[model samples]
Structures are given as structure tokens and as C-alpha cells.
Target: MTKILVVEDESAIRSFIAVNLRRQGYDPVEAASGEEALAVMEQQQDIAVAILDVMLPGMDGFAVCRALRERFPAMGMVMLTAKGQEQDKVQGLQLGADDYVVKPFSPKELLARIESLLRRLERPTVELGSRQEASFTSGPFIMRPDQRKFYKDSREIELTPREFAIIKLFMENPKVALSRDDVLNSVWGKNYIGDLKTVDVNIRRIRQKIEDKPEDPKYIQSIWGYGYRWLGGD
Candidate 1:
């Protein structure tokens, strides 16, 4: 059973989420604040996912999500915010959150989002029977599917789970022009509901990490008004 970290200052909402999580057979570890959530995570290293409230007491959910991504790149993150504004959702995703739920969200919707995140996290294997190789190589990039490891110019690049998925999708389908919708459907899951610009934000982040010059990216190129395509040489 994967343990879930629930971080919310409001006692009633915290308990409500924990109870629902329990009903769904998830073991939820609760925390009343961002600081306490970090402490809890330190004691419990097995936490697979963290449900973070944007309106945290001190650190705030954006900061927490950023911190947690650095500390545990593999762990999944979902942001909970009362605001349904597109900017809030975009900011959370930019900070490495896997998903976001507006406050007063249906329990079923929340659980479904959680399950989607978990499923993506568990994708530890990518079979390539036809091309027997230790890793997939394109230009200066090398990806070890089994290890979820990525390297550029022979230097390893640390990636959040979301970033990893986005990069892998591009690497696997090099030269194919993929629209924002295509990227979102492939990386964020088909059920994801958000602005198409979310894909652009993620792509920009990935470019910064992997490209020699993000301003003039060599591998990822925008196709005028259509979308983006990978130019990495195989």
C-alpha cells in the first residue's frame, strides 16, 4: 500500500481528505502545515504522493511543491487550491506538481487524479525488443528507460516526474510534430483538464535543462502556429 501525504492547515478539510483517502484504501499521513509536512516526509520516506494545499500556513503550496520536487523527484505531487484560475494551475504545474484540484472538488475526481498520477509513476519499464540497447540515444541525449535516467552532453540532468514524462514522449517520437493537445494527452494523461499553454510551460522548462541555449533550442522547435517537434538526431 502506497502512503499518501496530506498537507492542509484546515483541520476539517484535512480530516475530510484523509477519510476519503482511507475509504479508497490509501494510507494517508496528515500534516497541518508545510513545515510539518516536510517533517513527516523525513520520518516517512515511503510516501508515494503528496496532496498539498496552496494556502499553506507558512511555506505555501508552490514553495512546498518546488522543495519536494528537489528533495524527492520521483514522488508525485497534486496541488489543492481554492482558486480555479488558470494562472494558479499553471504555476503549480511549473513548480513540478503532477496535478491540481480546485477546492470543493468531488472526492471521485480527486481519487481518479491520484490514480492517474500513481499509474504514471509506476511506469518504470519501456520495452524495446526490436532494438536491443541499454539506453535510447539521440544527439547528446541518452535515456535509460528502466532507470528513468536522462543525460545530456554526457552530464546527467535531474528531472521531476512530469519533466521526465515530457522528455520521454518527445524522444520516443522524434521528428513528429506534436500539438499542445497531443503533448498534454500523452504526458499529463487524456483525462487532464487544463489550458493548452500548460504544455508550453513544461516544454520551456525542459528546454532550459537540455538545450545549450534555451532561446534557440536545437532539439525542440515550435512549428509556427501548430505545435512542437523534436529535432534530436537519432
Candidate 2:
């Protein structure tokens, strides 16, 4: 059974989520604080997903999310933010979380988000008769989809799974102005329920990693009123 970590200070809420997860056949490991969550992660390295509540007693979910992202790049994460906390949502995404669910969210919605994330994280396989995937090269950057590795100027840049997917999409469609919907659909799936600003936040995070000047991005250019375009080549 897949294991999911639920870190929420409120015991009632945490228990509620755990029960729902268990009903869906997931083994949920519960924690009451960020510190405990990290400890749980240390002991259970095989945990597939973490659902972190933003308002915690200590350390807070954002900090925990950052720590988890740095320690386990491939593990999926979903932030639980209070409804109307727009900044919290953006901060979680910027900190490498795959998705966010507002408080007062239904179990169905939460499960859907988790299911979508798991789908995104699933490793791709090459069939016996299929051609091997090729590496993408854009100027100094190289991305190997099969290896799930990305490098710039011979230096490897660590990226979350979502970040990798977004960059791969941009590289695959170089010089084309892709609308926000295009990116959201390609990376987050068409059934994703969230703000379009999620796309902008993710793009900003990517620029910080790849651009020398994120304030004035060179490779990932903004299309203004549309979305963004990738400008990279030999």
C-alpha cells in the first residue's frame, strides 16, 4: 500500500484526513508538527506523498515543505492552506509543492489532487518495440527525460517534478508562445482545479533556477496578455 504523510497540528483534522486516505487504501502516517513530520520522513523514506497544513504549531508547513523538497526531490507534496489565503497558496507552490488544497476542501477534492499528483510522478517506461527517448538540448542546458536529469552549463540544477515537467514542455515547444492554459493543461492536467496564477508562480520559480536574472528573464520570455515562450538554441 502507498504511504502518505499527513502533517497537521489539529488532531481532529489530521485524523479526518487519515481516515479518508485509509478508506482509499492509502496508509497515512500522521504527525502533529513540522518537526515530527521530518522525523517521520527520516524513518519512512519510502513515503510517496506528504500533505502539509500551512498553519502549524511550530516550524510551519512552508519550512517543512522546503526541507522535504531539498531532501526528497521526487516525492510528491500538497499544501493545505486556509481558504482565502492567496499568498499561502503561491508560497507553497514557489517552495516546490506540487499542488495545494484550501481548508474546508472536501475529501473528494483532496483525493483527486493526490491522485493527479501520483499520476504526474509516475515514471515513464520505454516499451520493447518503442524508440528510446532522446535528450533535449537548448544552448547550454540539457534535459534527459529518461534519466529525469537537467543540467545547465555542465552543472546540474535540481528541480521538483512539476518544475521539470514545465521546463520540458517549454523546451519541447521552443519559440512558441504557449498560453497559461497550455502549460497548466500539459503539466497539471486538464482536470486541475486551481487558479491560473499557479502557472505564473511556477514560471517565476523556474526562472529563478535557470536565469541569471530572473527579474528580466532571457530564455523564458513573457508574452504579455497571453502566457510565455522559450528562447533557447545553439
Candidate 3:
């Protein structure tokens, strides 16, 4: 899945963008401040895009954007702010922001840019060498990369295309907590604006089947402030 980091201070606007993006089928991660955004990065290494609000309280968007560019120079970034200042836009672009938009911009337009950025991030698929190719497994959950099939113990698990994609990501990175944005990009395409609740809903369905007890959940664990992890047992 493609991962997105949203750095915005305003609760209303932050949620506004998040909900819309989620409904469109993209995983959306939220950071109320730049500090939190950094912490999120520490846990996840496969971020594809960042949506930054320029007038942040503590660290400001420019510093964060510049810092991110220094490390992940190829990562996509989109800056947002109430300020219409041309200098700020120029600075953000110089710092490696792919797109900059003033506040009050349409949610539709923002979603469009996000999709374009993700499209640019993807590289053509390559065939893995036979020796290096590996199947992802946890308990009865088994993923066959060659066949793209998921099995519970030896029984096949029924899944929609999206569900199959989500399972593939978790099985591939067991133990690592994946944020919602990461799930979305990995399972759904980037720029997919959809309901995030869909992730939670699907997880519930997944738990019901693989776990001995869904309420007392095992295998796929929720990481609270983070996202989900496939921890191998129930």
C-alpha cells in the first residue's frame, strides 16, 4: 500500500481531508503537529507522500519538508496553508514539495494531486530471483507470492481483491505496525479517496475468521496510535 503522512494542526480540516481521502480508498495518517509526524516516520519507513500545512505550531512545514527531502529526496510532498505567500510556495518547492496549495482549496483537487504523486512513486514490477523469493506466513495464515493465494492453515481464505491486498501487506511485514495510510496505499491505489472505517470494518471481518476469538483478538493486532500488525498468533 502507498503511505501518506498528513501534517496539519487544525482538527476540523485535518479530519476533513482524512475522511474524504479514506472514503476514496486511500489510507490516511494524521499528525496534529510536526512533532507527531516525525514520531510516525520513526515507526514507518515506506511513506510515499506527505501533505503538510505550512503554519504549524512548533516545527513549521518548511523545516519538516526540508528535513524530509534531505533523507527521502524522492518522496512526494504537497504543502497547504492559509498563507497565499508566493515566497512560502517557492521555498516549499525548493525544499522538494511536488505541489503546493493554499488553504480552502477543494478536497477534489487535493485528492487528484495525491494520486498523481503516488503514480510517480511506483516503479515497474520486477521478477524476483527464485532463491530470494519467499512466502509470507504466520500461524495458519500463509501467503504464496507465486500464486497470490492466502491460506488459513491449509484451508483457503475467501477475500475480495482489496482484502487480498491487505492480507498480502500484513503477511509481508509481520510484527511491524502499519499505519492506516500505509495499508491504503499497499492495498488500494494512492489517490484512492475512501472511508477509513472500511479498513476497521475489514479487519473485523478478518479477525472473525482467523482468530479463535475475534473479541480477544490475536494475529493481527491494533497498535493504538499506530496502525495494524500481524503478530503471528491469536
- Candidate 3 weakest lDDT stretch, 10 residues: 117-126
List runs of model 3 lying over 4 Å from the truth.
124-234
TM-score of each: 0.92, 0.96, 0.52
Q: lDDT, candidate 1, residue 75?
A: 95
- Ranked by TM-score from best down, the candidates are 2, 1, 3
TM-score of structure candidate 3: 0.52
Better of 2 and 3 by lDDT: 2
Ranking by lDDT: 2, 1, 3
Question: Which candidate model has the greater TM-score, 1 or 2?
Answer: 2
Question: What are the per-model numbers of colliding residue pairs?
Answer: 0, 0, 18
Pairing residues by index, what is the TM-score of model 2? 0.96
Residue pairs whose backbone atoms clash in candidate 1: none
* Strongest candidate by lDDT: 2
Clash count for candidate 3 is: 18
lDDT of 3 at 57: 94
**lDDT (tens digit, per residue) of candidate 3 on 10-72:** 999999998888888878889998888887877875877889999999999998887776666
> Poorest 10 consecutive residues of model 2 by lDDT?
123-132
- Candidate 1 residue runs with Cα over 4 Å from true position: 126-134
lDDT of each: 0.86, 0.93, 0.73
Q: Report model 1's TM-score to 2 decimal places.
A: 0.92
